[model samples]
Target: MALNEDLQLQALRLLQADPARSQRDLAKALGISVGRTNYCLRALLDRGWIKIQNFRNSRNKRAYLYLLTPQGIDAKARIAARFLQRKEAEYAALQAEIARLRAEVKADAET
Candidate 1:
């Protein structure tokens, strides 16, 4: 399933913040339901954006940690650029619309 832009960005940010975070911790940090977090994480994993590796914690037992693959880093960079471009375009359009509306209001007031 295609995630909304906000979800995508959130997932990227959460991963960036702590690659070793569990899905539960990530869900809490993102203020999203655990199911949704799991879904998004599954999508990311399927896309090869992250890899789960077994590592021993201080307790010496094996535990899993998520790591961003090289492809994941590239994806993050591309997403960031696209997000910036979209925001810029949206700002420009809103500014033009505001100017147009102001002009119309001024003309109406004069008449």
Candidate 2:
């Protein structure tokens, strides 16, 4: 996945886990700047994947709740599946490299 897609996936997962998290908190968790977080959020919003609602009774009047739409839920699932597949492929490659190195080391020891 591209960097933006990766960030979006992380953001969506984080929001699903805790929709009440602020953008600053999200940025911290994502290890990104708040401006980038805001950009990702705007993209999600434009895609109709999430909706922002203000919490009227909250102490922070500017606080918002980010809720995922049904489409967003489905999108997250698909993205997760793809991410898992990519990780699995990487794992397989690493395992192959490890096995090759071990065999090479054993052959060298015999000589």
Top-TM-score candidate index: 2
Error of 1 at 107 (Å): 1.8
On residues 1-111, what C-alpha lDDT tens digit does candidate 1 reach at each position?
677766766787778778778778888987888899889888888989888776665453444677778888888888888899999999999999999999999999999
Candidate 1: stretches off by over 4 Å = 29-31, 58-64
Q: Give the TM-score of candidate 2.
A: 0.94
TM-score against native, each model: 0.79, 0.94
Prediction-by-prediction clash tally: 0, 0
Query: Where is the poorest 10-residue window by lDDT in model 2?
Result: 1-10
Per-residue CA lDDT of model 2 for 1-111, tens digit only, reads 133667778999999999999999999999999988888898899888899999989999999999999999998888888888999999999999999999999999999
Clash pairs of candidate 2? none
Query: Each prediction's Cα lDDT score?
Result: 0.81, 0.91
